[model samples]
Target chain A: MRIVAALLRRDLAQMFGSGQRGATLLPVLFFIAVAMLYPFAVGPNPELLARTGGGVIWVAALLAAILPLDRLLARDIERGYFDQLYLRGIAEEVVVAVRLLAHWLSFGPPLMLATLPAAALLGLDSETLRTVELGLLAGTPGLAAIGLIIAALTIGMRGGAALAGLLLIPLAVPLLVFGAGALATGGSGGIALTAAISLLLVAITPFAGGAAIRAAREG
Target chain B: MEPARITATDLACRRGDRLLFRGLSFDLNGGEALQIVGPNGTGKSSLLRILAGLLQPFAGKVERNGEVALLDERLPLDSDLPLGQAFAFWNRIDGAGYRAEELRPLGLERLADVPVRYLSTGQRKRAAVLQSNARRAGVWLLDEPLNGLDVEAAAQFQARVGGYIADGGIAVIASHQPFDVQGLTKLHLGDYAP
Candidate 1:
């Protein structure tokens, strides 16, 4: 239990603490930038902005998740952190799971907070903003899980970071569809589906990512 | 601590459809050390990885009775963190208390305040040795442990290995450089090449 706590603390410090302030802040800034730009791209008509704004937020959140993927597992693997951890009788799955939680903790809540300013910029009503918030809450964990899996799978390849970004887009479609669909459908059903996908992805990430890392060691 | 040993029988290694070595076998016991020496591309590093359980042997099997520690080309410390803080992170996970004396042999006691990125190659290698030592695991698998050390540091490292073996630890080193240790068995890996 202490080992897990230590791993989580170290991971959190690496991702969101003073050492990586840029990493923690970049996604939130990018999220707001996207919200700020959508109005200009589609023209400043409030009705259209409100109607499409929730989906735009979902897209921006997904892209923001990708920005950190390159830094996730690559540096650890290259520096032999995984091997050292494995030597201590700690399984790879345990490390991957800890990393998943830390990754979500770093980006998910901040992106959620940034949504307030984003909502105002797009002129979204309180009801629509609520749906967007709920959708992101349900969907971001799944996005983090997918990012971890892709990062582990691409650990040793050249141009792996760019490839990981491309790979994440296809796998994340389910979460994006259900999350953004909540606004247009005006129901809790899409949010529930998004949460369900998030649960599945979160459960699968540890085992799949663990296997990918072990395979990478052989290469 | 329980007695620890590593036994390998007729191990074979294949890399990219090419067989690097075959018909290799050795047994290492506590209070003992073995140095593997060979030219480049002769599977010295591969043998260490195999013994470390990070690589699969093409044939045969390896059996071990204790936790393994490896010192390789990569430094596991966080580059952005000061050496002390980075070591503290591992110390928490490893349940180890930092000993200032461990840093003395490598002349690293004063560099703990420096970030890992600022350390020179030999300094980084010394830090890696200290990191592995912190684990106090029974089996130590070191690849090229003497690559970048000065003569004095190299002597210090050799002395440390000797002390570790005296304390009932197992050390298996892979290096092309000559290593001097009392009662240390030297294995020429090229002899096992297919």
Candidate 2:
């Protein structure tokens, strides 16, 4: 338990603490920027913007999650943190789980918060904004989980960054479909299904991510 | 705190399609030190990893008793954080009380505020040694432990390894450079190459 806490603390510090990667706060900025760009790309059609804004937010959030993938676990594996931790008898499953949590904490809430300005940018009505925020709250955990699993699987390979990003979009389709679908239908059911998919991903990420790491170690 | 033993029998390691080393075997109990010596690519590092249980040996089995600590090329400390802060992370995981007496001897007291990435090679190597010593494991597996050390640091490392084995610990080192540990037992990895 103490090891878990230590691992979690270090992970949180690394993801959100300071220095180049942490201080960039890139995901949230990218989220807001993506939101900001779509309106201009489609011209100031408030009606059209409002209609597509929620889906745009979901796509933006998904893409933003991808931005942090390269730094997520590759460098740590390359640096031999995993082997050291394995010596300490901390399970990779636990480490990956904590990492998933840390990854979400690093960007999930910030992306949701950034959405407020984004919602305003796209002229989303208050009700739609509420739905979009809730959708993100439920969906980002799944996004972070997928990002971590892919990060672990792609570490050390040539052009891994490209493969990781490409891998994420397809794996994240469930979250995207249900999360953005909630906006289209404006239904609680969509949100619940999104939450359900998020739970499944959360449950499996530790094992899947752990196995990928162990496999990477062997190869 | 107890007698520690790590034994490997007929270990074979294959990287990709080629076999690196085959039919390698060794045993180390408490108070013994084994140094793996070979030229580059003869699998000194792989043997260390195999002993440390970080790699899957293509063949053979290993049995270990007591905790293991490995100090390889990688410095587990966070590179972006100040040295004090980085060590603090490990200290916390290690149940917080780092023996200041052990650390001061390494001559790193003045580097507490430096970011780990900014540390020179010798400094990083010294930090790895300090961290491993802090672990107080029964078995220690080190790869290229002397690569970046200055003469003084190398002497300090010899002292540390000597003290560890004197305290009934086990040390397995993989390096081509001559390591001057007391009662050293050497394994030339090339002997097992296929």
Candidate 3:
């Protein structure tokens, strides 16, 4: 437990540390940027904006999560942090799990907060805003999970970050379907299912990421 | 820490289609220092990884009874952080602190405020050595541990490994250059090449 605490502390510090400040905010700004641009791209039709704005917000959140993958596993793996942790009796899964939490903490809450202005930007009503926020709360974890899995898998490959973003879209489609679909359905069932998928992804990511780390060591 | 033992039986390593080494075995006990000497691309590093349990052997098994620490080509320190902060990061995880005297021997105290990326090759190597020492693991797997050390730091590193082994820790070094340490066993990896 002490080891995990130390791991969590290290992971959190690394995720939000000084040098990564720009990268950390890149995702948030990217979310808002996407929100801001949607209006310009489709022209100023308030009805069309409000109708599709919730789904647009969901899309922005997913893309923002991908922004951090460039440094995620590759930096640590390249720096030999995972090897040292493994030697210290800290399993790769623990590192991946803690990283998942840190990634969510750094990316999720802020993106959720950004949605406030994003909702207003797209002129979403209070009810639609609430649904978007709740759906994001349930969906972003799944996004973070898939992001991490792809990050681990793509480690050491040339042009991996770009490839990971492409890889993530297909995998994240389900989360998008369930979470963003909730906004359209106006039902709690969609939110519940999104959370379920989020839970499943979270559970599987540790094992999958752990194996990827070990395999990456060999490659 | 409890006494440590690292043993491998008929261990084989293959990188891609080509086999690196095979039919190798050894027993490393506490207070033992084994130096693996070989030409480049001969899998000296791979053997160390196999022993460290970082890589799976192509056709063998290894039994380990204690914690391991590795100091390879990579420093493992956060490059953007100052030297002190980088070491502090590992110290937090290792649950041990680097004493002032320990830093002096490695000549790291004076460079504490320098970002690791700014340090020269030799300085980064020394900081990596210092951090691995901080791990205080029972077994040490060092790949080319003396790669970039200057004359002074090289001698100091030799002395430190001396102390590490004297304290019942096991040290395995993989380097083409001779390591200056007492009672060192030279394991030439070329003998085991397939």
Each model's TM-score, in the order given?
A: 0.98, 0.97, 0.96
Which residue pairs clash in candidate 1? Answer: none
Q: After superposition, how far is residue B54 of candidate 2 from its true place, in Å?
A: 0.5
- Per-residue CA lDDT of model 1 for B1-194, tens digit only, reads 46889999999999889899999999989999999989999898888889989999999899999889999999999999999999988889888746687677678889989999999999999999988768788888989999888898899899988888888999999988888877799999899988
User: Candidate 2 on B1-194: residue-level lDDT in tens?
Assistant: 68999999999999989899999888888999998888899888888888888898999988999999988888888898988888887887776435566568887788888999999999998888877658688999888899999888898888988998999999999888899988899998889999
lDDT at residue A190 of model 1 (Cα atoms):
98
* Leading candidate by DockQ: 1
Tens digits of per-residue lDDT for model 3 on B56-128? 8999999988888889998888888888877777777877757667688888889888999999999989888
- How far off is residue A164 in model 3, in Å? 0.4
List fnat per candidate, in order.
Answer: 0.87, 0.76, 0.76
Worst 10 residues of 3 chain A by lDDT: A2-11
Candidate 2, residue A18: the lDDT equals 65
Off by over 4 Å in 2: A21-24
Candidate 3, position B88, lDDT: 77
Best lDDT among the predictions, by candidate number: 1
Q: What local lDDT score does residue A180 receive in model 2, on the 0 to 100 scale?
A: 90
